[model samples]
Target: MSADKTILIAGTYDTKDDELSYLADCIRGQGGGVLTMDVSVLGDPKAPTDVSKHDVAQVGGSSIEAAIDSGDENVAMQIMAKGAAAMAAQLHSEGKIDGAIVLGGTMGTDLALDLCSALPLGVPKFVVSTVSFSAMLPPERLAADIQMILWAGGLYGLNSVCKSSLSQAAGAVLGAARAVEPPKRDRPLIGMTSFGKTILHYMVKLKPALEQRGYEVAVFHATGMGGRAFESLAEQGAFACVMDFATQEVGNHMMGSGISAGADRMTNAGLKGIPQMVAPACYDLVDLIGWQPLPDRLQGREAHAHNRLLTSVLLSTEERREVARLMADKLSTATGPTTFLLPNQGGNEWDRPGAPLHDAEGLAAFCSEMRAACPANVTLEDLDCHINDDAFSEQVLAIFDQWVAEGIVPEGVS
Candidate 1:
């Protein structure tokens, strides 16, 4: 509702000129500023946009002439998407736009994803699409905090139903821009990862300890989306250090499961030269949707159904060993100091003795493979305890303290 907040309304202005203009009017009616970016490649809007198609193509290192010459809709749109994304990022960097609302069907949605991803985590991004929440959009393709609304009955022309979706999306993006509070860098921040307390309780102890030392702690759940967000921030060099304990996503990806954080999950912090203390919590389990048929390889394997929406399957010893090798290979490329914490007893609650998903041989195979494959650059701490044990948390703090003392990790503010 604030007049000072500006929202970037982006779409194919040539085809959906009426729709995009209505969205802009809705924002203006609420006393919010608007910036329009036209991603239409073939035709022009009746009037000019805040950013034109020629400008977008030029920014993407091509020209409108070149795009038209290509004669392929997909290729031309891709060119526009790249330019539009770069322009959005530029606008935000230059303090011109506070948030963005992109409108489209399938093609527009594809471009919208890239545009929103170009912005940082906290800036509001709303996508009003016909394919809202459709399976065609993969988890890895979404911006972590992207908001979407179904453009019900609003595909071709403006009607009451479509207008409702647009009006709400316009207000939502503006309101979010006005109300959002992005994390401040007042203190050094630590990015840690874990599951819930039932399986990994180390965060309950580690978070407060890290904060007491004058650092902020952010513990990310290692679910598919959560890991995507964690990796996105890490790619931006957002953390002073990282405690990456729950790496189930890596195993999920290696096992070809649908419940995966993208292939580059465990590599971001290292690529950015952020000091990381890593562990394999939940490394023995590959989570699958509870309602779906189990994968053939996991047909008779031990499993624990977390709920109607989620299930976890224990990996065989050979699979565990293979995953260990995968983890080591990913960690081997870190440019900064790295430590690997290997717990001998168990990785998670379900892997403890007599637990439903417990597998001693698999755990042993994982540990043995990790001990052998861990690169020379990574310090391997083979601890005689479960990942959930008090000693594991203590070892983490001790190593962090040592890093601070050795100047590998900077001291936190008082």
Candidate 2:
């Protein structure tokens, strides 16, 4: 394949030959190069392709016949994703690709997304699948510059809507390829997290403050995916330091709030030994979908809806202690200089005086437990102010500056 503007079209050429050919032609007609790879395990493809089913099986460490013979669709799909990712990684390493596209049903979409995930972010990745809307493959794993989820039926016999969707998707892919450019660095990379309630606060205050500090702030919404993305970037050494303000997701996971970041969220920076400043920014409550949607055990407990989108379930004394323990466990793993700032008055706006989820006793329990459990290497400080207080913000920034200074020249800057 030509390295310049080449698009890798990966899928089962036997089943998707017509659609694949149509896509390939469309890409070529747009003055772009195209390479097709067959990922089908069962049949020989009719189209002339750069990579065949045999090639994937060989790279994937399994035979196509063996996959087909297994009769297990899930296993087969996993093999395809693994093989396709391996192949794509190899091609990427060779610098022979600029973009990629794939078409399939549920299985095909899964396979393509896996391969796409293997590719670096910002690359053109597209998937035209029959089950795009119904299928729930993780979009985070895909490798394309843009993902266009088209609603269509089986790959065979296209309807008017399907044809229109495919055409639009093709245009999007080509447009992405032509328009894609490297990100410009004019701002410092500041890592920030927020939920729907505090989003306005972040957009107004913390973001502007960081930008004023001559840093480009990368904000991660405190959803599960946002936290994962931030952690992923940290693992890649992408941030100078992280200001993990909205750590409420930790509570989510702790309380089974549908939005947990799992165990890996806070561990990345600590393991990477990056300078970090953390806070119980919104620790007063674990987020749920709605007040009535809470678990039966949690029913009648103090709950408040921050907005229509988020319901906050107040943490009990027991839950607070558990969250504190988990926080301490995560903090103990830090390899670099770190600080945990506790806002004595409240963690979030919702936990302040006159707020619905406020619980001074529970908050105190959490802080005390964390202080007792935290390793000596990780500094713990309690501030007599709310999280949004300017004093708190200044303290965090000062501590961050000190950590950065220590990291830059460990012995003494003087």
Candidate 3:
């Protein structure tokens, strides 16, 4: 490939010479630049390349000989991942790379995925690998960001089958680079969370209001993965502020509910130093698949059968206190502006008066405990309104606006 639209082709150059060369030719035919980097442990590279063993060792901090001598796959994998990331970062800084492509077997796939993850989201990055058809952990982690995996069947060298796959992979990266536009940020990006029950409320008022105010609101369903996706974007600097309403997932995390957002859901915004407006929007209960399928320990608890497929188990005073403490601790780390608004009347639709699981005492205890544990920088406000109420939404928006005006949000953040 000509050294002209920069593309970094990384792989075990000793093993996949034909496939790498074919891909390089395809890239050059499309008028793209190519820089081949040899990631092989052995000294002999079958193909001609710009970056060699010395360059890889200098960037990766470990020689291939050391990695091979150790005979530990995990350690070698880690070293390769670090090396690829460093090289990718250096290329990105030099503004020489328009995209990147990697061809490898299972180990190669893992290394490529790690390097892709290191690049900022939206960069065109692809991997042609033998393990792509399987549900691999690396691809799952790099979803929609920078990694695209093309499954090449069989473990052997790049035969006819592998060559075709590599060609298609090359085309994909070039296509993506030509078609994708750098993200435009004319409006502030607001992160919001919702569940099936609250989707109507959000669509009707909250989303529209934010959009009308020159903000791009991204609504994530509070499923197990949905919460994590939102947090990932926040960490990648995709959001200007957050409106975390469906915090019910935290209850799942605390009570072993099936819909837990792992432990990293609520802390991303805080760690990223983004201004956030939080609420116990649906933390009154933990969600389960169905009332009949409830665990034996949860059998006697009051439950709300929201649908045939979903049920919510009410939290006791003690459980509510625990949840509140968890929320407080998570929010306490906020380095930027933050406000935890409590809907005193109820937390969710089922927490209202006359609801079977409604318990004023439990809610009161949660509010008090959370307030006590919250950091001095985080302001706690108790609004005498339901979470879905227009007034409550407006109050939260006003607080966000105040923070923005005070320069709490970093300057130049849309």
Candidate 4:
């Protein structure tokens, strides 16, 4: 009745020895194997660990003496974090561990992030942190599938309340490890980006078409976190081709909005030499957190309160031009084949003729800038229709088909 999977338990053993041990015991009780990693800098644990602090320091390319002599807590912990991350990643790669669970407060959570991120996207990584889901954790630092549980009342000493959280976290990681089905690569994978149907409907038609053509399609939402995941996969060279149409996260990052994928968004696919079909879908908007005060530069713009949590601001004509230039600049650096798809009338549903966010003049400005700023290496196709129209999808299919015929894109699964 026991699970055969092994879970790596990581924490500062000198400080949280009892708590970390409890997590290990819970996993073992469920028939799961345990491997413990101690990332402490100053003190020794009551019991020796599977991976000791000195071992972590050495893996991080420094010695325990060097870390202690740094005379700074942050510096010492960073050394430990680097070592712990590498060790965990190495263990998983060698098939010695199936999943990992890390326990900590702020300092422990910081180290936990690096350790979890070191593992690829789908090897279960869980964190028990005092600052779970807090603003202190930036969106860019999060791994796409990382899980977190709040350490609640058990910060100092383990109690019944804290035990509830720990016991659940232990069981959850073990369960996830046993249940996860790694992605199958039976067909060539195509990565596409877009909003939901209300804003962008191309994916509704595109996904099935791609699948019918013997390819696998993944549609990523163009919100902050979603874009981050898309970019991370692109960097890994995981896609056969990328249909990157929903690109608002680029402008969001350029405008210093909190809802940003990252500064490196849009450039990864190109850097990896992955073929990309780029478009400026939703390029006329900047997303901001509704709960926070609006930035001064965006205070007076046309705004749509999507929900209590999010607000979308319509960019000025001049702002739209700036974003177009930024897109062009990013495409200019592509070492791979790149194509720019320009829909002359509008980019999204809200920017159609009579919609609240529509502005013909703004759309025209964006189009002109895109035409003028597009790089010489990129093939630009100007479509005389809105992005949401049937004609737009047809044009996309035409380009995709041509690429497949020319051997630029991979052949569909036979």
The deviation in Å at residue 237 for candidate 1 is 0.6
Greater lDDT among 1 and 2 belongs to 1
| Residue 39 error, candidate 3, Å | 2.7
Which runs in model 3 stand beyond 4 Å of their true positions?
1-5, 15-32, 42-44, 65-71, 104-106, 128-144, 150-154, 159-167, 186-188, 195-200, 211-214, 221-225, 248-262, 284-321, 346-369, 410-414
TM-score on alpha carbons, each prediction: 0.97, 0.84, 0.77, 0.95
Rank the candidate models, highest TM-score first. Answer: 1, 4, 2, 3
TM-score head-to-head 2 vs 4, winner: 4
Candidate 3's C-alpha lDDT?
0.75
Clashing pairs in 2: 116-143, 123-145, 124-145, 125-144, 125-145, 187-216, 188-215, 188-216
Q: Compared with the true structure, what per-residue lDDT tens digits does model 1 show for residues 1-414?
A: 457899999999999999999999999998999999999988899899999999899989998888899999899899999999999999999999999999999999999999999999899999999999886787677787899999999879899999999999988998999899988889999999999888889999999999999999998888888898888889888899999999999999998777777889899899989999999999999999788999787899888889898899888888899999999999999999999999999999988998888888788889999999999989999999999999999999999999899998889998
Evaluate model 3: give its TM-score: 0.77
Candidate 4 regions exceeding 4 Å error are 1-3
lDDT of 4: 0.91
Candidate 1 stretches with Cα past 4 Å from truth are none
Q: lDDT tens digits, residues 130-223, model 4?
A: 9998867876677778899999886887899999999999999999999998788889999999998988999988899889999999999889
lDDT of 2: 0.74
TM-score leader: 1
Question: lDDT (CA) for every model shown?
Answer: 0.92, 0.74, 0.75, 0.91
Task: Tell me the TM-score of model 1.
Answer: 0.97
